[model samples]
Every structure is written in structure tokens, then in C-alpha cells.
Target chain A: MCVLAEEGYTGTADVKAFLAEHHGLALSDVDGHLYHHLNEEAIRHLFRVSSSLDSMVLGEPQILGQVKDAYGYASEFKSIGAVLDKFFSKAFSVAKRVRTETKVASSAVSISYAGVELARKIFGDLKDKTVMLIGAGEMCELAARHLLNAGVKGIMVTNRTYERAVKLAEEFDGTAIRFEEMVSHLKTADIVISSTGSPHFILKRDDVEEVIRIRRNRPMFFVDMAVPRDIDPDINDIDNVYVYDIDDLNNVIETNLEERQKEAGRAEEIVVTEVAAFRRWLDAQQVTPTIVSLRRKFDEIREAEVAKAMSMLGTDDPKTRKVVEALASSILNKVLHAPVTALKNDGNGRDPMELVAVVRELFDLTDGGKDCE
Target chain B: MQTLLLKSTTATYLVGALLYLYFIVTLKERGARLGRMFLLIGVVMHLFGFGMRFAEAGHTPITNLFESLSFFALVIVGAFLATELRYNLRVLGAFVAPLAFLFSLLSAFQKSELQSLNPALNSSWLPVHVIVLFIAYAFFAVQFAAGIMYLMQERQLKGKHLGAIFKRLPSLDVLDDINYRCLTIGFPLLTIGIITGSVWAQDAWGTYWSWDPKETASLATWLVYAALLHGRLTVGWRGRKAAIVAIVGFLLVVFTFLGINLLPAGKHTYASIAR
Candidate 1:
């Protein structure tokens, strides 16, 4: 089983050798083009995965949480080593930035939510408005739930079958009105949200006019969520009647999705910036351990020789001994300056790791102090 | 002391109005709170001013142009606050508070001298007629504001822009509800106010009906509101049409209060509002 843990595996040569020798795994080399396509080209794969950019559904939210859970599980298993520790944290931060700094998850991505958004625009506050459902079906029921979430004051359901209306209304904690009495009840409903699988139109212009008359021409919003709209399109001509069909609602959804995609672009930018920052920090740090050990080894040799010479001169001339010690330390510092400068600066922003490797080999420095946590 | 109180009240309302208009332009909801606070403070000061004047005069303190118009402004704020409490719509104040502020500003310029009530106008019904009528006017002002908001929201919805104001203002249903509520309450009060006015006129002038310009205008205003009420309930005549009616009715009320004096046949001039 070649369990290539792309997330937690840090790709150490020793670990790969051990896995191949002990687990009888073959080290299949990825061609240069494939490696670029997989790793270099999409180094922010963690970010994209967390933000659901890799998922079939564009900008889905659950993947981010799922990615977090997976990282948490890996952390619990003591599996993500030091290298992946930094990578996962950066990924989490990118995901959070994408969530907040952009509108990726703010707008509605579903038809039901689209209806609710339209309702919000027409009637600024839904907390006091009544929503009437002309018929109960899967879509109608879903829309009813969305309206409920929007804080509509009450819900009224009417259907060809009174029993079905009663059932739907009961499930939603609403009242069931007779389909025939929909006109009379229209006087009370500020929003008429309907989706019925009927062959013909259930409501007509004259019917709406009758309701408008009863309502004294107060504003009435009708959302036809069905293909064959339950309400007449011409009812919009009535003084306070506003009707929207399923296509209009779909258009709203499409617009909202486009907005989310735009926001996703911003999210990707943030991820790219963060990934580059993480990489720079990683590059700047790979030689930190060797440099620290080298400095330690030089200081120990200088201190040992100074202490031995001070004992030979004795405590009889403390000032003279101190001057000798200062001279000795100054010479040591002068001698180490050139090498330290070379190690610190590798021209044109090149990685200092190469210099550290050469210096470590020359000074016999060991990996004694890893700089990154 | 009365003059000082009226001036302070006007200042307070001015502040309130500025805050509300600021909210309208900026879409900052906190402006509504500050505006409401200023209006409430102004209302308190105005009532105190009226109280002190009433104590000094041994009457309702509505016997002069300054006193009457100032009282008119006060009642408008009071009615608006009542609706605010009922509906709890903070945005309502943003639309309606400025009118109260403007009215009070005009009242500040009104002649503030105290005057005794004329014997002809000293019937027990004096307070009933004037108070109810001014209150009716205030409700109509609120109705007018709601109507304007409804129209603006309608335009935004039709244009499909749904701008900041469209979102900040109450929905068309809500605005229409405000209009309906104000009308239902204002209509009956207006009817009663008119009836009381005629009774006072009958007692003072020995006639129940007159062709006085103010009287005719008041009747016209009443007829307009009555028709609106009738149309709303009987025929479902609401929304844009209802909003238009409220706006028209408010114009008539303004004319009944300010324009009736221009007529040569006017027995009741705007000054007579204080009578």
C-alpha cells in the first residue's frame, strides 16, 4: 500500500527509503511536468481544498470545516511533523481569511435562499409579514422553511387537497386555509410564496384584483416557484401586486453565484499571497540550526583558550589579564566575521541553505538547534 | 420663560431633523437613535412650555398663532412617537421626524406673545376640536411620509437596483401598513374634530354650517380622507393609489391650515386657528 500522505508526509529521503525497504513500496518517480502540475503549480492545494475550490460544487462551505477536522485528526495522531505543522496552520489561516475578507459564503447559493433574498428586498423587514404557500411540495416546503428562517410573522398554506395543506401547515406550525378562500386570505398575506405541481394556473389576475380590493391595495408579493406558475403573470398589473416566476428567482440565484465567484477570486489571491509568505519564511529558516551550532562551537573554543591563558597569567595583575582577554576575544570575533557574513548573505535573495551546508561541512557543525518551532 | 422654552424646543427638533436627514443620506442606522433622542427631548420641552403657558393663561394656551402652531408641531411629534412605539420601526422616525422639526422651526418664528381666548371661542369644546384636529393633521403628516417612502421603494424594486435607501426604509407592505394605520386613526379623529368644530361654531355664531373658506376647506379635507378610507376598505384601493391619496390629503390639510386665509370669503383665517 503506497499511502502517499500528501498532507502530513514531509517527503524526507530517509522516510521514503525506510517505507520502500520495510513496506515493499516502489518509489515511482513523477515526471518533471507532472510534479510541476501537482505541487509547484498548485502549492496552495491545502487552501483550495479547505475553501472547497477542489470540490465539484464551487464555493461549498462544508469542506473547510471538514478540512479542519482532518487536520485536527492528523494532529491527534502525532502524524503531521514540524514541516506539515507550519503548512496546515497556513492553510487554516488562508481558509479563514477567504471566509471573512470575501463574500464567498455570504450570499445565497440555492433557489430557496434566492426566494428569501427577493422577499427581503421587497419587504425590508419580514418579521411582521405573512407568507402564504399556495401548494405544498418539496420546493414549496423548502421555501417555507427559508421564509421561517427569515422571521416571517406567520405562514398560511392552501392546496387543492385540504388534508395536504393541513399536513404541510402542521409541520411548519402554520394555519391551513382552504384553496378557495385563498382570495380572502390574500388580504392578510404580505407575501404569497407558491410552488404547486399543477397543469394550469391556480390564481388569475381577476382573483388578485379581488384580493387587492379586499386588502385596500396594500402591496402583495407573489413568488411562483413552480414551472407552471401557480399565480397569473398579469396579476403584476394590479396596483400593489408584484409577481416573480421561477425563472426570475433562478436569475437572482445566478447573479448571486456570479458574485460568489468574484469573491472566490479574491480568496484565491489571499491564498497565493499567504503561500508565498509561508514559503519565504520557510526558506529563510532552513539554515538557522547549522548557523546557531556553528556560532556555539566558535564561542566555546574562544572561551576555553581565554580561561586557560588567564589562569597561567594568574590573579596578580587583574587589569592586565582583563586586557589580554579583551584582545583575545576581539581577534576571535575578527576571525569569525568573514565566515558569518558569507553565511548570512547569499546574493540576490538566493536561499542561504547552500552557504549553510558548505559552512557546516567546513566547521563540522551539527544540527543542534532547529530555529523553527 | 415661555419664549425660552419654545426656542429650546425648536433647537432640539432642528437637531433631530438634521440627524434624521443625515441617516437618510448616509444610511447609518445609529442616526435614527440620536434623532429619536433629540425629538423626545424636544417633545418634553415643548409640553413643559405648553404647561407653563397654560398655567399662566388659565386656558389651553392655543389662543395665538405662536401658541397654536407650536402646539401643532408638538402634537405631530407626539403622534409619531406613539406610532414608533407601536411599530418599533426605527426607520419611520428618519422619514417623519424632519417634518416635526421643520414645523417647530416655523413655530419658533411664530409670534410668542400670550393672548387670552376670545369669549366666542371659549366653549368647553375648544380643546376637543383644536387638539383632535391638530392630532389628525400630525397623523396625516406621518401618512404622507410613509406614502413617499412607498413610492421610493416601488421605484427601486421596479428598477431592480434595491439601493441602500430601499433597504433602509421599510418595505412597501410596511409603508402601506403605516399609511393604513395612520389613516384609520386619523380619519375618525378628523371626523370627530370636524363635528366638534361645527358644534362650537353653532354655539358661537348661531349656525351649524357656514360657507367660510376655512370651513369649506376643512370639509374638503374631510371628504378626501373619507373617500380614501372608503376606497381602502371597500375596494382594496391601496399601495401606490393609497399612497397618492395620502399625499394629496396631506396637501389639502396644509392648505386648510395655511392657504384658507388667502380666500376673500374666509371667515376663519390661519390666525383663527388660535381662536
Candidate 2:
């Protein structure tokens, strides 16, 4: 069977077509099979791959984690059977090994830093600069620490949860402000890092414009690290009010290729090695049923011949019958030896099922033949 | 000790940048591989250069603006490498390699004249503060890449330019998630950097919160991201608008890092390092 990875597949139709053309399996057929085979353990594995379980950042280690989880889950559920199970399990183990051995998850490179760095570029020294942290989540805490480290004068953490805000603020040695006073703090803050999980803009354009007025022409750097984003997009149009969301940081991140190239070679080698091992295990699996069938055929032939011989020597000694039985078994083994070796040595070519059928026909094994070979 | 290695490394970076640009235009996977190889070579050279500089300086190479900027770029590259390994985002190399090369070039042009540390910058906390701050900046650089990708991906989705490159890029959701995660991690580092720098300033200069230009610009950048994070969580601000905000914030960081340093009136003058 041809093995094709679904990675480069783009459109839904393309994926479906490729699976059908290459694997002779329709998308719908695999869809039900895939989800049905998924259990709690599989879900947990998926989560691990997605990095939903990591302490610093979820989904950061997701791709490898997902691949490993899929393999493990497939094996445990017996969805892949013995052959596929071995193949998938090996892949998962390799991925896990790479993750452990490499320094892939060391740095927390991100957009929030981009926001802070941009502020630094605008302002020469962060010392004595006032910062307003709009959200009290982990994102805010991180941004707050960055600003504080840059010599920002003070930090004010505001969150929906008063206790969370208080906790974050205390940890950073900053003040905890009520969510209601967010705008008041905005008016004074020279920099703001927002990562609230709200569904709407917390800082409206008008509200930010008013704050800009209060702060005079002094620039206010706004870093919207939230997904839905915390500040109004229109706020970006406001003069001296610089607003940046996630995309702006990409420019800054693109400059690190030189450093990353050093490790890519190692990672690529690991992936290739694992893929080869998985392929071998998959190939070896095809011969198992053939071996079983061949042994059974030999057993059936031996029993039939022994029965015939027993009748011929019925009036003779019992010792003669025992000799005849041993002789029949030895003859059956000699007959099957060459075919068994051929089946084992088929490499990537021979079909095990075809060999099983041939052995059955050769022995003339009838229905309900018991314990052959 | 290894001056030749340093020069060769910088040369390698220049070559890598050209190859990466070719990969971008050609869209060949092999081009990407070649670019990556060049970049790897450059990194080795860059590291060697740093070693030589360190030996000559007799301390951490973060005492002056020139050294600080050089180290800053190095940290950015290091952070980028880690992210690439985790995410398998080789496409980003096309953009990042040039920036690294430019920073190194700038460093190369910088006057290497050794000067004694000023009374205020002589404290033990100086190195720690600078290192933390630079590392934080490196993380922000990653966020910038994610942010840019988010915007490009969004445009592709909207404009129907879902070509091979577009397909190769991560999903908008993934980029957004990564951007937020990076910010979450870097923000704390920045906070600590700011706090420690403040303490150092107080000990040496007799005051903190002087509202110097550098201080003002840093605060502004901090406020912007704080708003972005808060706005995202509490208000559900996202997509194009959020991305635009992130982009603008990064520009401000550049201004603060470069523009404020050039300003003549600020107490945080770039004069010490510019010489």
C-alpha cells in the first residue's frame, strides 16, 4: 500500500481526492473510523501534542505531541492492529525523544516582547515609565515583568477578577487597580499591555483618544496581544497612539533564522529515521497470517494421510502405527519448508494472503480441518 | 582569539540572506534547505565572534550601547532558533535572517573603542538588567513574526490568495495563539528587567521614575501591549485590528530603541555608545 502524508494537502476536496486516489479510502470512511477509534486517552494525547498541557505555553509543542498522541492512541485501541500499532508507536517514541533531547521549548519568543521592544525603541530608557497592564492573566504578568525589567517606573494591573489582579500585582510589586478604573489608568500610562479574554474592545477609540489628549503629544504604545484583541483597531489611526496586534511582531521574529538553522538539520534527521523504522514494521506485518495458514495446512495433510495409513495397518502392531504417524508429520514439514522460507523472504513484494490460498489448495484442506500442522 | 571566524560568520550571514531571498522568490523546498544551511554556518561564526569580543572585553559584552545592541541581536537569534525548533517554522527564516545580518552589520560598523563604565552603569545589576531586557526584546521579535503572519494569513483567507506558501503558513488561529503565548512569556521578563533597572538607577543615580525619553518610550510600549492583552481577554478584540495594533506597537519599540537614542535632549543619550 502507498503511504502518503496529508500535510501538503490543502483544500478539503483535495484532501478527500488524494486519500481516495492514493489509499483507496474515502474521507468519509476514514472520518468515522478516526473519531470512533479516538478515546479519552487519545484526547489526552492530542492535548499533550497541542501543548495544552505545557506550563509556559499551550500548543507550542503541539505538532509532535499530536503525532505521538495519535500513534499511541491508535496502538492502545487496537485500531491499527499489531502491524500498524508497532509502526505508529515507534513514530511517537521518536517524536518524544526529539522533544526531550532538543532545546526546542527554551525561549518564550512572542509578540508581547515585540510591543515592549517597540516601546523601548520609541523611549530610550524604560526607567520611570508608567505601565498599565490591562489584563491580569499570565500574558499580562509576562508583559508586566518585561516592562518592569526595562526600568519602567510603576505597573498597574487591572483585571475582571479583583483577587487575580491583586495577586498579579503583588507578585510584580505593582499596584492592583479595579477594572472600573481602567480608563483612569489608561489616561496616565505611557505603555499598556492588554490580554484580556473579552469578546469586545475594552479600550474604545474615543476612550483612547481622550487618554491621548490627557497625556499630551507623548506617545503611548499599545500592545494588543489578545486574540480578539483588547483595544479598538481604530485606535491605531489615532496620532501618537501606536497600537500593535500580533502580526506586527512577525517582522521582529523573522530575523532569527540564522540561529534556528543550526537545529533544523538535527530535527529533520530524527524525522527521517523514525519514518524508515515505521515503514519496516509495517512491511513485516504482511507475512504473519501467511505463516499461520501455512502451518495449519501442513497439519491437515498429516492428519488425512495418517488416517489412511492406519486403516492399511489396522491388523498389524500398534508400534507400526506410531512409526507411520511420525513419518507422515516429517513428510508434511519437508513439503512446507521451501514455501515458508519464501513467504518470510518476500521483502516488499510478495502478498501473504496469496501464499495462504496457495498452501490451502495444495493440501486440499477441507472445511472444519482441525489443528493442521 | 577568533577574529577570522567572526568575519567569516558575518560573511556567511550575508550569503544566507541572499539564498533565503532566492528561496522566497523561487518557492523551492531545496532553496529553503540551502538557506538554512547558510544560516547555520553564520550562527557558528557569529558565536565565534562573540567569544573573541568577550575575551577582549574581559566581562560580559553588554557594557556599552554597541555591545548591548550586538548582544541584543544575538539574543533575538537565539530566541528565534528555539521557536523554530518547537514550531518547525522554517518559512520565517526568510525574514529573520536579513534582520540578524543587518544588526550584525551595524555592530561591525560600531566603534570598538573600549571605555570605562560610567559611575551609574558600573553596578553589578547593570549586566543582569541588560541581559534580561535584551532577552525580553528577543521574545517580542518572535511575537512580531507571528503577528505579521497572522495578518498575511488573514489577508490570504480574505483575498483568496491561498497559494502554496499561504497553505504552508500556520493557521490564523495558531499564529494568534502563538503571539499571545509569546507575549505572556516575554512580558514578565520585561517587567523584571524594568524593575531591576529601576533599582539600579535608584542606587546609582539617586532616583527612579525620572521620565527620561527612554523611560517614556518603554512605558508607552508596555502600555500598548498591556492594553492589547487586556482588550483581548476581557473584550474579545481580535483579527485584523488586533494584528494592526501589534505591528504598531513593535514600531514604537524600534523608535524607542533607535529614535530616542538619537534625540539630543534626553538624559538617556545615545552619545556614550555612538562614539
DockQ of each model vs. true complex: 0.32, 0.02
Predicted candidate 2 versus true structure: per-residue lDDT over B1-275, tens digit per residue: 44455545566777777777777766567777887788776676667777777677666566656665666667766777777777666767666667767776776666656566555566688678878877877777777877887777655443332343454566555566667776777778878888887888788778887998888898898888788788767655665556677777777777777778777676666334454
In candidate 1 the C-alpha lDDT for residue B168 amounts to 68
lDDT minimum window of 10 residues, candidate 1 chain B: B266-275
lDDT of 2 by residue, A214-290 (tens): 66445577877788878887787765556777665554444323223444456546555555544443332345555
Shift of residue A360 alpha carbon in model 1, Å: 32
Model 2, position A39, has a per-residue lDDT of: 26
* CA deviation > 4 Å runs, candidate 1: A1-110, A120-145, A148-220, A225-232, A250-373, B56-58, B115-119, B122-124, B158-161, B270-275
The weakest ten consecutive residues by lDDT in model 2 chain A span A1-10
Error of 2 at B150 (Å): 1.5
TM-score of chain B of each: 0.94, 0.88
